[model samples]
Structure formats: C-alpha cells, structure tokens
Target: MAKIAFILLCHKDPDAVINQAQSLTAVGDCMSIHFDARAPRAQFDTIRDALKTNPNVTFATRRVKCGWGEWSLVQATLHALHAAVAQFPDATHFYMLSGDCMAIKPAQYVHDFLDRRDVDHIESFDYLTSDWIKTGWREERLVYRHWFNERTQKKRFYAMFELQKRLGLTRAIPGDITVMIGSQWWCLRRQTVESILEFRKQRPDVMRFFRTTWIPDETFFQTLVRHLVPERDIDSRTLTFLMFTDYGMPVTFHNDHYDLLLSQDFLFARKISAEAHDLRRRLGVLYACEGARFRISNEGRSLFTFLTGKGRTGHRFAPRFWETESTLGRERDLLIVLCRKWHVARRLVDCIRTSTGLPCIGYLFNDESCALPDLGGIQDSMDKRHRHRRALLRMLYEHYDSDRLLICLDPSNLDLIEDFCRDRSVTRLLEIDCDFSDRDLIEHAMRVGLAGDGTPPETLARLLPTIRNDMALETDTLRDRNFAHHSRLREADPPARNARAIAAFLDCSEPIAGALATTDQLFAE
Candidate 1:
C-alpha cells in the first residue's frame, strides 16, 4: 500500500488540529506537525500531549517563529516537510494541510485517489497573465517590497504597498523566473518534494528574492513546481476547499455549510472556526460515516459500489420524510422545490410564496431545446459530469444565505440533493411529479418553445426516459428514508391541492392555507 506523509501546519486551535490528525489514522501511518513557535508554550504542550500516544506522529524539531506574509510561514512548512520525509522516507506523497482544514471525504478515498495517480496536484496560475491580477487581487504582493511591524503597523504597510501600485512605482519583478501564484494547498509526489529541496539548496538567490516578497508562502511552492514538473503531469487543481467571502477572507465553515461542503468533490475543507464546537463534532461524525463506506473492500465489486453503487443491492431503502418537520416548524423561511419542468417549478415557487408569504427561489434545469454547452464533452463519464454539475450548483448556492434560503434544485440533480440533505435539517423536500407521456411531453415542449435545438429527436427519445427513470429511482429512495417530511405534488393536481401542500410544507396557519387556496383559484381562472 502506498503511504502519504501529511505535513500539517498548525497555529492555536489545538483541538481542531488534534481532531484532524486522529481522522487520518485509518489511511496513513505517519504525520509531521509544526506549530508556530510564536504561539504560547502551554498550547503547544497541550497539542503534543494529545498526540503523544500516536507513535507514527512526529513534531518538527526546529519550528520557525512563523508570521503571516513573512518567509517564516514558508520556513515552517519546509521544516515540517523535511521532518516528514526524514521520518517516513518511503511515503509516496506529501499532503500540505493546516489546523483549520479537515478531511471532508473518507481518508481512504483521498488515499486511493492519490495512490492511483502519478500526477502532482498543485494549484497554480501565471501571476501576470492570470485573471486574478487582472481583477486586482494580490497584485502588489510580489511587485512591492513591503515591511511592517508584526504586531502594530501591518495594515499601514499594506496601505503603502497599495499606494506604490497605484503610482506605478512598483519594484522590479524578477525577469529570470515566471511568477506563479495560487492557493498554497498542494499534494506533491515524493520525487517532486525532493526536487524542490534540491532546488532550494542550489538556488538561494530565488529564496532570498521570495523572502522579501509579501505572502511568499502562496507563491513560492507554486512557482517552483511549475518550473520543475512537466506541464502535462501537473494537475493544477487543489483538492482542498476554501470558501472566500466578499470581505477577502475565508468564510468559516459552520453547521449550515454542511450540505454545501458535501456537495463539493474536494477531499478537504478549511476555515472551521474555533468557536464552532458543534460543527466540529458534526464533521467528525460525518467523516466517520464516509470513512466506513471506503473501508468496505471486495476488489472490483467494492470499487464499483464506491463509484456508482452497482453491486449494493438487498439493503432496504427507507427515507425518513417529515422526521425534521417539527424541528423545521420552529423557524424556516425557505422551501426548495426541485423539478425538471420549469413551468411546473415556477408555479410551485409562486404557490409557496403567495400562500405562505415566505421568500422562495427556484432553479430549473435548462429546457431540452436549450441544452447546456458541451463543457464536459459528450464522452465524459457519468461521475465526472455529476461532479462538474455539482460544482456549478455549489457556486450558485453560495449566493443564498443557507439559513434563510429554501433551495429547490431540479430533480435531475437529486444525487447532489440527497448528499446535501444528509447533514442538513431541511424543513421539507417537495418532489414535483411530471404527468405527461414522453411523446406527448416532447410535442408539448416543442409547442411551448422549450424543446432543445441541438439535441436530436432520437437522443431526446432516449434521454427523456432515462431522466424519468432516474427521478423515479431517486424518489423511491428518498421516500423510503424521508417519508415523514417528504411530500409529492402532481402537475395536473387541483390548485387547492397545490395550496394545501405549499402551506403544509411552510407550516403556516389555517388562514394562510385558505389564502393560498384562494390565490390558486384566482390564478387558475
């Protein structure tokens, strides 16, 4: 079995660091941890004692006095990486992680993904040509030599850096090297790490140059890897997820972000705040459940099940609908209705909002006539297509306040919805039923100006049944598990029926239900 050397950088938040380390016990035998030397000794001792029993864990003997934007941060990571390589020389890969980051997927899943691949997973982009610099992000970090007091005048120095950029008096950018900047999170092959260490030894000038640059940690490894690794072998996508807020800081993951986080295909997620103990505990529990799924091994059979649940039959499918209705009844302003039919979804959204006076937003998949561009290619595997779709939706969902938002995505994306609902206490999921026959629906869709222009008739003939079958399978599974809170509304159902369903889901009073009924009747006329 191939092993991974985890290089974990931590500062404060000892419990979160320790919890992250404990979760990796199943996948790897070794970890190298380095805490900021500037942190209090008491905290360091607490972390040391917590992991003392783990014989495979090693602490960096020469920890750097790390400071943000200083070379010390890079030095601390290097020290940990060196320690990790020395302790676990045979480990095939090195994963750079932080105390705030936790594995969102099963440890085994991450391990398998890395072990099967020879390519290095490092996120990088050319600084000058990248949209980031064009969009005015981190532009002055490299072009200006910034100096600041670690304690007092950090913001003052930042202002000076901006002033220099505005005046176009920026210092000379090194012409010898192509500057690559991106997220610091990376997973490198052992040979790649060794190559980096060799480069550091031979090119002290580059190190000296980067040492004076602001936020060198983000650009240093990325730039070096670009020069060392072949372009084809470098997969410039990090497996770690970081949600950046509008304020230019990472948004801390909380309980509400649970569903959104699971929707991502990334292995790790970061910025779980120290104050959120419940969220941390919930993450631990969720990780354990995901880890169990990965531990099941029956050669090709388990792999099939892992990816598509091919051989996993015989398990009873039961959805616990209405299980969280009472809890949801306390306070929930959003009702998500997901259906493929836009006209039906629009009506459902209107009914919910008019009946309950609650804010509702609905996202309908593109109608057949207006199919999505072949962004993922026609031959892309189902899994890859699903991942691409989920990533796009995850970005969209970020705009909504998860607390105040009721999300209703189309049923075509139910796999994503089911995964999202796993960690969330949604008030209710309204599955809208489509009643038209395939031939009749296509004819109606064409007449209604919703038919796809690009999709051939034969393709639509095949695609519609597949979509219907998938929705049916998903409905059956969700209904079995979430029967209590799960309710269905037929497209041809009476307007009163729609009103009652909407009112019931929103947990509104009898008066609101009557109002919805009246509104539905008025709309029908």
Candidate 2:
C-alpha cells in the first residue's frame, strides 16, 4: 500500500477551517494551497501563522485566480499531484481530498484498504439513471444556470427536455454523456493522475469547459474520463462505496446502504460552519491510525427509507400505500415536504394537531400488516385506508396532532379517529375546503423554521402584522403570531420538470468505467 497523502485545496479560511485541516492531515504527508489571487489575501492568514512550525506544509503560488470558468481547479489538482509526487515519488496512489472532508476511518486502515483496490482510480461510483442526468442538480449548478443570459436560460427547459426524451429511446447515443462523477476527492491511482494531466496539456477544451462551465468538479472529472475511456474500470460510486460488493450497471446510491442513510450520511461529517476545524481533528485521528470510516446509526436508515421512498430525496419504498390521497383533477398545487423519518412524521403530527381541530389516528403498521376495510361512516384521506374489523385494533392510536394536518377524510377514517380518542372529549367540525380556500396549509405555515438554520426570528417576527392584515385575521391576538401564509401554486419548480433533460441524459452511452489503461474513445460512433 502506498502512503496516503493529504491534498488540502481551499479558497478561503472560515473560522474553523485550518483547525479542521490540521485534524485531517494525520494519515499521510500534507500539502496545503490556496487559490489566493481570486479571494481575499488574508483569507487563511491565521492558518499560515499557526502552521509555521510544520515544515512539510506547501503553499500554491500567490495571485493565481481559481475562477469558475477556467482550468483553475485542474490547475490546483495538478499542483497538489505534482508537488506530492516530488515529495513521495514511490507512493502507489494518492487520495485527493478537500478541506471540508473528514476521514471516517483510521488513517492506516484507510490507506491500507485504499491501496488494495484492483483499479487505479478507486472512486466508488455507479452509472446514473436517465433521471439524474436530465434532472441532475445541486446548489452550485443551480447558481450557474441563474447566470445564463435570457435565451440560454429558457433554452434549458426546451433543449434539455427534448434531448432527455430522445435519449431514453436511443440510449446508445455516441457523443452525449451520462454518469455522475464522484466528488472532488477520489482515491485515484498515479496512472489516472498522469492521464488527466496529459489530457489537460493536450485538450484545452476539456479544461475550458471545466472552468467556464458551472459543472462542479465532481461530475466534470468523471465525464471527461468517460468520454476519454468509456470502457474503463472506474468505480463511479465513490464516497459511499465499501458496502457495495456488486459491480452492476445502473449503479445507484441505494445499492450499499447502512440500513437507513440518514441526512447525516448525506451531509458527510463536517458542517458547512465547522468545516474548517474538521481537518485537524480528522488528521490527528488519522495519525493515530483512524482514517475515514463513518459509523451509521439504524435510526438514520429508517428515516432514509422514509425520505427516499417516494423517489424523493431519501425515501425507500414501504410495502403498502402509507396513507396518501390525490387531487387528480383539482387544479391545485400540493407542495409536499416529507421524509421517511419518524421525527418528520412526529413534527408533522404536531402541526396537524394544532391546525386541524380534529383528533387523529396514529397507526404504527408492521410490514405484514394488511389493508383495512372501509366502513360507510368515516372520511377518507387521499388513498390511505383506516376502518377494519380483524386488524382494526392493532392499526389505530390516538394522535394528539391530527386535526392540524387538514386532510379531507372518509367516514371510516373519521370513525377510526373518534374510536381511538378514548375518554377524551373531542369536537368534530364538518367544514372542508374544496376550492383551495383554507390558506393555512402546513407548507405555508412553517417558512420561519425553514429559513436558513438561521436565528433571524425578530426579522421574521416583524412581518407578522402585514401577513395578519392580508389574511384578514381580525383579532389582536393573531397580530404577532406565526400563522400559515398560503402560497399560490405555480408550475412546480421548472428545473424539476426536466422533460428534455431527462431524455437526453437517459440515452447517453454507459460509462466504460473501471481501471483505465485504455479509455481512447471506446464508445465512439
């Protein structure tokens, strides 16, 4: 196994970044560089002073602009690669890293395992479905599209949708591409590094697109390599790999799950706020023989199953239809924010209790649970069932929070709720809104809680008067309260409807991904 190295590339110094970097440098030799010219010169000044005693640290040439539309990232990657090679020429592979990442495993164990991969590039990855490519998105790319001139911006919906639909029917299209690259950090062998560098020297187009294109470095590298060597043995599934023992086509994030892949796994270990200090803490542990393996909790997986189940962010499928209804012909918008976690359900339960004045039935169903029979008296919620004879007792519970959820109900479901609320006095109001009249839906009610894990409650609080005035809520008691603000349903966020994009993405050639000794246009027309 080659000695693992730390290639810390950063732009600015946040309060805890350097402290974080110091933590990550434990597993191997460390090289630190800043894209100094494009950012404030004093960005990581405190970091430099702190590291003055560390003789092995290296810095990039000052005044270099690591712009979005240029080969600056490649430049930075190469800079670290070239420098690391000089310091340790005999090392077999180098793990490219970012300042924000923390190694979940011990350093020696990580290096030893990383060094053992059969392929040159050990970035864990799988092929992307047509959906991801057409609808491929993240915060950064969204920012890029916003910078588009008016024409290009509109061209996206039309062009992307058309291409995506076409791609689905003809999945073997030659020049078009698919496959999401793993993140910027990959356990790449020295050979892959040389190949990418050689290509940089030979193909300015690749470099130009990387810089000028708003594509993040993660997708850019894999795309470039795939176009170069479509048949290569590259692991498309990078960050969360070890759990997957299968090497099948159409690789997905779900292949090797740690029971429930909670939001914590998705967020990786570092917070956007404390990311700076993670490096040092991680590095210290790496030196102590811990590298980068993250321990996952079971609760996370259960929640993940819930969130990703509907093919939304993190839902895994549940066997039966779990209480959902639809307004098939209603020209209304239903903006649903759901996750597979019990906490999300619990929170929603609370909201429902406060808003709807009706008592609720909280049923905890087992996978073996059968459907409930419908009786004539209760109301229905979308499509979920409630009233039954044999399995009735096991499926019903008193929900203190059901009324606030505000769903149209069937008679059986209503009766179920009434039955479950034992001894408690409950009042049933038969009022319902068919034309979107009730504006206090949960989506509009919770904007304050959604605004940036932030603490601007006063700023949010001040807007209450205007909101109350608009709603025509007459009472003085309602003035300062955080009430539901109904939003007009617009076309569901457009990029989400990537009709053209999805088609184009689906039809692209599969990655000849794997150990790349010969990726010279293997899938060319």
Quantify all predictions' global Cα lDDT against the true fold: 0.66, 0.39
TM-score of each: 0.56, 0.44
**Model 2 Cα lDDT, one tens digit per residue, 1-525:** 665445566666544556545554534446545544655757657667776676555565433555442445656666776666666565566665554444444556555656555454533243444333334344333223222322335586446535645665222212344434454656656666667667778866445445533444555666656655545556554543222112312222321221222212222222222322334443344445623444433233332232333223222232224223311112211111111122333343344444333333333221113223343423233232332321232222222212121222221132332332221222122211111122332122233222122213332243344444433422222223222321111112232222222222222122211111122321121
- For candidate 1, write residues 1-525 as lDDT tens digits: 557778899888787778877777544547899999888999989989999998678888687787777888888889898888888878888888888877766656677777777888988899877775435546567767666634457688768777877888776666677889888899998999999989999998888778878778779999999988898889998888875543576767776555445445577888877776777777666655644432211122121122243224343233334322222222333356666566666665676566544545555233333223344352134444343543433333344433444555666454456544543335466776676578655654444333433334443464466445655775676666663456666657775786677567667776676565454433221
Best by lDDT: 1
In model 2, which regions exceed 4 Å deviation? 14-21, 43-55, 61-63, 66-75, 120-129, 133-182, 227-232, 240-268, 275-525
Worst 10 residues of 2 by lDDT: 508-517
Report how far off residue 482 is in candidate 2 (Å).
26
Sequence-dependent TM-score of model 1: 0.56
lDDT comparing candidate 1 with the true structure = 0.66
Winning candidate number (TM-score): 1
lDDT of residue 37 for candidate 2: 62
